[model samples]
Target: MAELIVQARWLVTGVQDRHTPIGIDDGAVLSRDGTIVATGLLDEMKRLAPTATVKTYPDHVMLPGFVNSHHHVGMTPLQLGSPDYALELWFAGRMPARRIDLYLDTLYSAFEMIASGVTTVQHIHGWMPGGYDAIHGAATKVLDAYRSIGMRASYCYAVREQNRLVYEDDETFCAKLPSPLGEELSAYLKAQAMPFSDFLKLFDQLTAENQGQRLTRIQLAPANLHWCSDESLVALHEKATAANVPMHMHLLETAYQKEYARRRTGKTAVRHLHDLGVLSPRMTLGHSVWMTQEDVDIAAQTGTCICHNCSSNFRLRSGIAPLNAFEKKGMTVGMGLDEAGINDDRDMLQELRLVLRAHRVPGMDDDDVPSCPQVLKMATESGAKTTAFGETIGKLEAGRGFDAVLLNWKTATYPFQDPDIPMLDAVMQRAKTNAVDAVFIDGEVVYADGRFTNIDRDAVLNEIADVLAKPRTPDEISRRNLGRAVFPHVKAFYDGYIGDGPVQPFYRQSSSV
Candidate 1:
């Protein structure tokens, strides 16, 4: 019967039918066993739970912690030697990434996320060289890292069956290559293949292994349309439905990916997935950057969710997602810092501001652009809907988990702030890591002031530095050589691959959908 109470100067409970949060000045929250029981004035909370432990923040503004709905790895791809190539070429560029231990790698990003008020992550991990056991071990390490640091993680081992290198099939593409590169690439893809049933088995095993975990949940990922066969995609959708989990599949991330979908199925990615019977509330499309008007209609009608990785699109040269269009259609949208953010790190505070400002489409159309509260909803409640944890962990309300962030009001509004500006708007636009006074998840404070409560962040970073400071392993050297050798062919595969014509732009303001 552990009870905790946070008496804060202000409490942002949640957003309702308004453009601002449902806030209370001089408010408090009472929780028992990690679930919020009541929210009201400080005196009311104290009367309700007199025996609860109280933590007071006199000059802080409390809000729900954010959810990063789509993520891949801990370290950024750029940090691992991959240039800011376009999405298609970036895959080849990432082939030679130096290895880092999965546990440490997960922590590296978790630290950044927590510091910026991100409490949960949809950690989509994949592209391993070993079979089921190896992949499962890797998944365990990632999960362990999240648990060790007290952050919540909805983890899914991304399932990639084909298209190991380019948009072409593995066997077809390998046959076109010359000399040892052919055998080398084939062997590499072969090492990653397993019976499709094994993927389901792995999901079941992970679910069982995480039955009683509060900080962990297991979900499914189909990797992407080009990487998954139709049969496997259907099977994964069925499995996820039966297991009561969500699927975050990367689709139409780039113009080339949109082209691939059309070439393969003679239809848009959304249409193909809809025909396959996979589009539903349970399916979350990672990046709908190049979706057509019809695609938006399909996604809206079928209740398919969207994850707008704003910075990832810019960094990879993927077109900006028409987020305003999605909102206009009443589609649920979430924010994700895929691969890396605009600044090449997982700072959700920075990511939030980027999303807020990026979608202003150069017009004074009141309803066409996103508002401050709308972006906040995307980061919190809508983002939670994309993961296995659902909407249960996104808001501050009765029956919801007690996860929140407290920002120093002075720091958030330092120097001078206009009284006409809303508190959330002022904070979103100006606050940085220094304003992040505390982060709470599951009724417990995991990060406070300048450090993680559960782990020594500096020690872990030094450990990573020491490991990388050593000479590259023989395996790493070989992969680097292979990447260099195959770079030319990989680039050549997309030579005039995209048909030049008037493709649909990011979005149209007024659609009848």
Candidate 2:
């Protein structure tokens, strides 16, 4: 019912035609009823929302609020000691050692995210079924919290069809275990798991609730890395296609995964998915860090989006994603934090900087891996597109959703006299989470001046601490034992396999663009 008129010193209306600041003074954006009405010179916008409550901030870069394409937002507790191992062992060990609750943890993570200038997040809610109901309820609470805060999110209630504790015949288990960890270990794990159909039914229930509440929507992710059968993958793809929603999963993340797919299907992971008819623009893959050049080509051809988990990749020693190669192939690559990071922070700016720097080809370096603008797109536009939110929220265009963040340039971006340098570079190199002065989603300020208006930060943290202190689930306990056995083996396997290969780093030959 109320209109908001904001006049900033500079506005980076993320429209491609007008990405740079239009003016140094008197630039404004008008929004009413949670939608942007106009954006232009301050004089023009003021006339559009003449009677509106006006808010102004000078000397800031008003750009679109970042969208984190892939993250386990609620998995904060697990990421605490994350830098110690690779991904498989990390998941195996940490899932058991950590306590996860969808409700409180989600809120705490969301609060952290929003405060750090992330307006939208795609959360991978990988919860086991023993506590399914509680997880669902907690997720619902999280969605409600997001709505109240005016944040956008795409949630994935991760569907893992394999249950480790429920054992099945050696033959069946062997068939599923991607070759290396075969029938022998399969006996230790479960084969008779919940059917994919059951997960679909659960998806239906969740979607029904979504329709009822007008809350945040979730995509259907069939776990990752050839974990689901062909039939299950096909079914899930079709369901997502029919429902007109996005589907996501981890892909080609580790050497073992690539090896597993190669041994089982005689193709790489992305290729295997393409053959299964699951490759499409609608599907967003996470941590495509191990993709080959051919895989990059395939992703380009199929228009499958990828979330580059830079922090997680480096932290787990997963190796740098072929980001430079992917760009050359013209594939869509977005930035992701993936549960752990430089500071366990959800700030995409930090992730972007890491992505830009880490992938540089060593020794023959010339600044070629990625430019600041490229990394910015990975965090903003590209990330939004992966979650099917790009059409509206990625940019701060006049007609698009007014989702933007304000950076306090005085503190974070000092000595800012040059307009020749792209604001993207300044934001990436100099800005910190504390520099995020305010954030607006759907045309309204949700967070500003170092405080959150949606939820109680202290209370959320207390609740998370309480929930995380609870006892582990039975499945988690089993996973812990399995991890203790498998970690040493995994470490040895990796050590033996990837033993001292020539490190090929990316470097920019020229700044043509």
CA lDDT, every model vs. true structure: 0.90, 0.70
Measured on C-alpha atoms, candidate 2 has an lDDT of: 0.70
Candidate 1, 1-513: lDDT as tens digits = 999999889898877742768889988999999999999998899899999999999999898999999988888888888999988888778888989999999999999999999999999988888988999899999999999999999999888888878999999998999989988978877988877888889999999999899999999999999999999999999899899999999999988998999999999988999999999999999999989999999999999999999999988899889898899898889999988899999989899899888888766776778888888889998999999999789999999999999999899887899979888888888888889999999999999989999999999999999988888899888888888888889999999998878755664545668
Candidate 1, lDDT over the whole model: 0.90
lDDT of 1 at 454: 99
TM-score, per-candidate, Cα-based? 0.98, 0.85
Clashes of 1: 0
For 350-428, candidate 2 gives per-residue lDDT tens digits of 7767887776664454444677666777777788888846566676655667777888777776756476866656766
TM-score, candidate 2, is 0.85
The prediction achieving the highest TM-score against the true structure is 1
Clashing pairs in 1: none
